[model samples]
Every structure is written in structure tokens, then in C-alpha cells.
Target: LQELPVFAALDLGTNNCRLLVAVPTRHGQFRVIDAFSRIVRLGEGLTASGRLGQAAMDRAVEALKICGDKLRARNIRKARLIATEACRTAANGVEFLDRVEREAGLKLEIIDRQTEARLAVSGCGSLVERDTQGVVLFDIGGGSSEIALIDLTGHRSPRLANHIVSWTSLPVGVVSLAERFGGRTVTREIFAAMVEDVAVRLHAFDGRDRLSHVLASPKFHLLGTSGTVTTLAGVHLDLERYDRRRVDGLWMDRDSVDRMVEKLVGWDFQQRVANPCIGADRADLVLAGCAILEAIRAVWPSERLRVADRGLREGILSELMADDGAWRSRGRQ
Candidate 1:
């Protein structure tokens, strides 16, 4: 019997390190064979220091070592490992990646913001319904938030990313914003300040107005792919525990989103930590994410928002499989 060919994708973000290993399935989507995720807080002090700190680097390295082991264990036909926001902004970003290569035996490429936006759209492609005309997709990362304006008015492209008309990568993410505004002890005033700050940065984007027009149409809606939005969905569902099957592709209207954010704001740090979904790992940072989400909402004001649990990692897997013709090859076999 022929062994199934595997593909792997690793995403090292400011807040989390995630890996996905999969084999192409019949429906063009890949089936996960193995996966891993951990909050490494690689960008914990990056905003203040402008460099990757020793402690943070150590944490990230340890996570990467585990990912490397997973990759080596599989017969990976193609793999793409990437570092985002944290590595892109830190002064010693490349140096840290060098250490990662040496210590983890995995080469990680620091992709630019454009590629980051593209990959995010690609990852959440399936979430966009075929009838949808225009959509605004955003990924709130640890060190940055990427917002892409996708126009599907004319014809739907095979690659959802092809429909992206404009996109922006905000320097502020959950970690950076939290560090700036004090993630813990967030009052309504503090959260508002964070939202205002992000909104100010967003105002400079030339596409905001054009996207705003697209958003006015009922056919358009907001799509969010990030820990922040997923946590919101989980909290809204009041799930005893986090479940991707329930959270991913879940829809939350504007009022529902507002209620969840308000509920979170009312809770103190300990309460947030106590929540099953927003446990100790995300207790401090979840509000920072909410603030960014608020900023996006202020700009787009889409009535309905869809949650996506997948992003860059799925995008990388899809791209690698397509490039390798893995599905087609499987068909022949």
C-alpha cells in the first residue's frame, strides 16, 4: 500500500505558535493528520524594546523545536513555515529566525504584510459563501491586524485572494495594543481609547471609503479570523469549553458581538481567566483583541460578522497542495 503524502504548515505569530499537518482529501480540502498550538507570547516585550527579548526568544524556540519534530515525523511532501508581525517588527527578527533554524531545524520565512493578507484570505476562502458579493476580512494578530477588502461583484475567482481589492496591515495587534493600553484592568474608557487609537491609524488607509461603500450593500458582511473573534464566538455560545467545530463559520450579528464584548469588559482579569474559553493564556490579551475588533466595526459597521478559526496555516497548506498538484496526483493514483 502506498503511504499517503503529507503536507505541513507552521505559523509563528506574536501570540501563538501553531502547526498543521494534513493530507489532501477528495474535496480539495486537506484532512488534518496532526496539529499543535501554544501561546508562546513571542512578542511580549517587542513593542517596548523594539527587539526580541531573551525570554520570549527562548519560549518561541522551544515551541519551534516541537513543531520541527512533528514535521520530521511525517513524510511531508511540501511544507511552508512562516513568522509574522513579531518577527517583521522586531529589530532582531532575522537574527531570531536564524536561531530558530539552527536550534529547531526548521527554516521560517518572514513573509511581508501583503503576503500575510493574501494568505489570510486564502485560508478563509470557504467561509465566503458563493452568493456573497463583497466582504471585509480581518485577521487580528499579536503584533498586527490585517484587513482585506474583497470584491466579488464581477466574477468569483478560483482563489478568493484574487478578489481582494485593497488591504492594510495595522501595526497594532492584541499584544501591542494591550501593552500600550494595559490589557489587564480594562475599563470601558480604556477600551474606548484603544479603539480610538486603532481607528486613527485606520483612517489613513485610502481604501476605507471605498470599502465602506461596498459594506453599505446588504450583500456584504464582515468576516473575522483571529483568536479575538473566535473567543467572542465561544463566549457568545456560552460553551463550557472551546470547540472549533462550533466556533468556526459561526455567525454573530452586530448586537450579539456588542453583547459579548460588553460582557467581557464587565469581567475582571480573574473572571476572564476563569472563563473556560478565555483561560489564563488569553485572559490578559482577549480585551486588547476586542478593542481592535471594535475599531474594525466602527469603520465597516457590518451588521453580521462571521467567525473563522482557521487562517494562515490553512492558507499555506492549500497553496502547497495546489502547487504540488497533490490532489490531482492522488486522483491518478
Candidate 2:
């Protein structure tokens, strides 16, 4: 292949369905050319009912239809679609995937927790610090949070290659959080309560002295790949609208994150909905996401947190393209 063939990856999460189209470049990198995401809240009622709601499924299918159109338009050579927590927990998940494959002309893979953690690390590896002795990566999503502890000294210890020594999937997300606590108008007390709730949950996965371990290392880094961090980046930049270039790979300190949360919490739902960055789609859920971030920060008090706008979709694209060795070789040559 003279030119790298186009590839696609779709991620259907509990709250959002997203698609990305990209082609590998000569520099051993893949650049996304087009992407789409829709908030269908696929896991809207999964928390209470333990099953995906029909309305939610319909909303997801509609988003998939749009994704199908985009994939067809891009003439993608290979594509992979994966559904996360929502599908994994849904009793009718297999039935939904079957319908997606037949109706959307796309096959869906429901990945397990371990695979989810690995893929997230792969997709956001660029954000990892090279000189760090150890790093903790946490992804806060709509239905689950995946935490990975990466040992940067892995090359020194063969056993450390699988350095994700500590990994956990928290059974909470923005949708569930928002639904549990009123997302309409949050006061400072309510926000603190929400953070405390998440913190209590984190007690189950607390790493003994991970903060101290990172504090002792000069190269310690924090990588967060989730809507929460990305949205914070967007708000921090004070963007009139969402811009990935300005949001991705951005850095924010603890104080900055706290300020943003305060600003959003102070805003009524209507005011938040009016903000271009928060918009109608994310206004309600953004506060809940902020609470999750606060909880993570409380546990790991990193001065600087790196944001990763990329996640599972990029991981899938990388995997499919990697499987095609000839295609990768062609890119290298």
C-alpha cells in the first residue's frame, strides 16, 4: 500500500457513543481526520434496573447510524466497534450488539475490564512520562473508572512489563452520579458531599503510599483520559466552543480544577446549558464529573494532571492497524 489505508474505531460507552476515522502516517503515528460523538446515556437506567433501557438503546442505535454513515463516507478499510460497561452489564447486551451488527453493518466487541485498562493505556501512552519511575492512570467514564498503576522502571524488571499492578473498575460514572444527586443546581455543600461519596467508594481501591511513591520521584506524572478531564480543559481555556486541539494534552493544577468546579457548580442548570463549552448536552452531567475528579485528586494530590482527550476508540484503531503488519511495514518504509 503506497498510502496508509484508512481505519475506523467506534466506542459505545454507557453515556456516549463515539467514532473516529484515521490513517497511519509515515512517522508511526495515526492522525484522526474525522470523529463523531453523541450522548445517548446508554446506561441511563442500568444502575437501578440492571438493564439498558429501551429508549437508551434506541438513542444509541441512532448514533450508530450516524457513525455508520461516517465510516462509509471515509471508506474505511477496517473498523472495530466496542461497547463498554453498559453492554457488559446489560442483560440484553448481546441482543443489542447483534442488532448493531445487522442494522449498522458494524460488528461490536464487548471488551473485558483488563482489556479496557490495557487499551486505555495504549491510546494515551503519548501522555505518559518517559522518566517517571511510576505513574497512576485513571479514566473516569460514564459507568466505570479504570485505574492503572504503570511502573516506568519496567525495562529493568522483566516481571514489571505487566506493570498495571493496581487496576480497578469503579461502578460509578457521570450519568449515575448525576442521576443520584440532583444535577440541576448544585451548591458547594452538595458538591462536597458528592466528592465525599466518591471518595468513600475509592477507599476500596486505595493504593498504600502511592502518593508518597510519586512524590519521591521527580518524573511522576498523572494521566487522566475521560470526559471529566477533557471538559475541565475546555472550561479552563474558556473556549466559546469545544476545541480538541486546545483541550487535549493540556495541563491543569489542583487549584485550577477546584476553581472550575466552583464556577460550574455556581451556575444553574440553565446557565450551564447556555455556556458554549458545557452546552445542552453536558450541562447536567458535567458537575457530577467534576465531583469524580475531585475525589481522584483528593486521593492522589498531583500538582499537575495531564489531560488525554483520546481513549478506547484510539486504542481500538491502534490495535486493528497493528494487527495488519504489512500495512505497518508499508508506513515505515
Candidate 3:
């Protein structure tokens, strides 16, 4: 165990740049040894510009350089770095990647939406209980939302992603929605508009009703893996500061989610900033995220929501360890 090699995963998304370094723990799991996250807003103005702006690229590059340093300092046995929605949509996304490789000393591949949804489900697998009938797993990002319907009826696999029955990645996200609808001073009407926008988009997905057989099961629930859901969990707990230990895997019933969203809608921009769970970094964007969440609920109503603080980085680490047969010996025991 002492000689276990380290693995790293970096996810550069539309709103944040993050990295996770970990070592294999039990089967299908790992302990994070080091991590970093910063809100670079890589998709800033992307809705209108249709290209990766110089400023957004510079901010992302700077953060990537720091991540590069962390990777260099450790003996990374395997590493997978990925760019998400922002890079996928931007016209000069490839050009920006070239700059990152040259200047930041990191190579990031833009992963498709299906891969993104799969990794998100894989990362949050541990939170799903063995008795769970099914789950509507969703990750609301800055530039997009990836949702998957996991039907765990007949066969169960250690890899949660294997049970995925259907999935879809919506182009709408907090950043894009906020940019179009105004984030800081959103009124009830504006918030509704945002929700309706995403709802309309979601209505068009064929996967929305694919898991109908298990949708009404008493044990079925919604599992959210995103900053938006985490923030909601944090606020619901009334934490003085953001605490992943308290928020991760926490359960929030339907009414609880409603109360938090309503409370957020009532608060002004500065009030949103005042909450420790949602500092200035997310004050403007939180409502936009809520809009996305609201749309998901309307599509697949679930009374309970299980919040997962983990996502792509953890998923990548799990795959890397599994690929190398890191857990085979332990599993045999």
C-alpha cells in the first residue's frame, strides 16, 4: 500500500478549473491526496462571441499552469486531463488548447457529452446504495448539463456507469443561462424564463422517459453531482462555511430543495454573496443553476435528492486505477 503509485485528473470546465490527485483505496474508490479549484469562467461571453476570448483563455491558462506545477511535483503514474463544454463550443477551442500545451505545459482533450455523463455517474457511484431501484443522475455545469438514467433493476455492476439506460447532455448551463437572462438581479419572471428555457431543451430529449418502468419506484431518487446542488445542500445545512464533509452525500427532500431555492430567490445579490456556502464567486450564477435544477425536477420528479460533491476527477481516477488492476488483489481477498 505504501508503494502505491499516484494518479491525477484535471477537469477544465466552463466555470472552474480543477485538479485531483489520488491513490487507490478500496475497490472502485480512491483517497484524494491533493486538489485545486478556481473559478476562471472560461465560458464568459461565449454565448455571443462564439469564440474563446483572449481574456478567458488567459485566465484558464494561468490556472492550468498551477495545475501543471502540481502534476510535475508528483510522480503521476497516469493522468487524464480534459476540457469540457466551453472548449467544445468555442470556435478557437483547438487553438486555445495549443496555447495551453505550449505555455501551461498541459495537454487537455475535449471530451464529448456522453463521456462526460458516464464519468460523472462513475464518480458518484459510491453514493448510490445497493437497494436503490433507479436514479436520475445529473451534473449541471457552467456550459452544459449531463443527465443519465441509471436503471438498477435486474443486474448490478460495481461500475455504476454500466447500468446507464439512457442519457443526454443539454447545451444550456448556468453560465450561458445567466449570460442570456441576467444573473445578479434576477426577478421571478427572469428566473422562470431561465427554467423554461432549459425545460424546453430537456423536453426535446428522447431519453427523458427511457426509464419509465423504474421511474415510479418508491426507492428511486435523484442524485445531483454539481456545484449548484452542493451549494443548495450547504445552504440547507446553514453551514457557517462551505464544508464538503457535511454536504457530500447529504439528502435533501423535495420541500427542502424548494425552501433553499425560494430563499435564494428572495435574497438580493449581496445577500447571496453573504452566505458562506455561496460567496461572491457564485452569487450571480446560483440562481441560474437553480433554474437548471428546477427544469430537471419537472422532467423527472423525485422527492429525495442525494448530493454528491465528487465528479469527473474522481471518475477519471477510478478508471485509471481499475485499468491498471489496482484493486484486483483486494477484491480477491
Q: For each candidate, what TM-score against the reference?
A: 0.97, 0.90, 0.98
Q: What is the C-alpha lDDT profile of model 3 across 1-333, one tens digit per residue?
A: 368789999999999999999988777788889999999999999999998788988999999999999999999899999999999999999999999999999999999999999999989888999999999999999999999999998789889999999999999888998999999999999999899999899989987887788778878999999999999999999999999999999999999999999999999999999999999999999999999999999999988999999889989988888888888955732
- Among the numbered candidates, top lDDT falls to 3
lDDT of residue 269 for candidate 2:
89
Model 2 over residues 164-261: C-alpha lDDT tens digits?
Answer: 66676777888888888867778888888889988988888755354465555657667889988888788889898889888888988768877887
Model 1 TM-score (2 dp): 0.97
Poorest 10 consecutive residues of model 1 by lDDT?
208-217
lDDT score for residue 306 of model 3 = 99
**Alpha carbon lDDT of residue 249, candidate 3?**
95
Tell me the TM-score of model 2. 0.90
Off by over 4 Å in 3: 330-333
Q: Cα lDDT of all candidates, in order?
A: 0.92, 0.80, 0.93
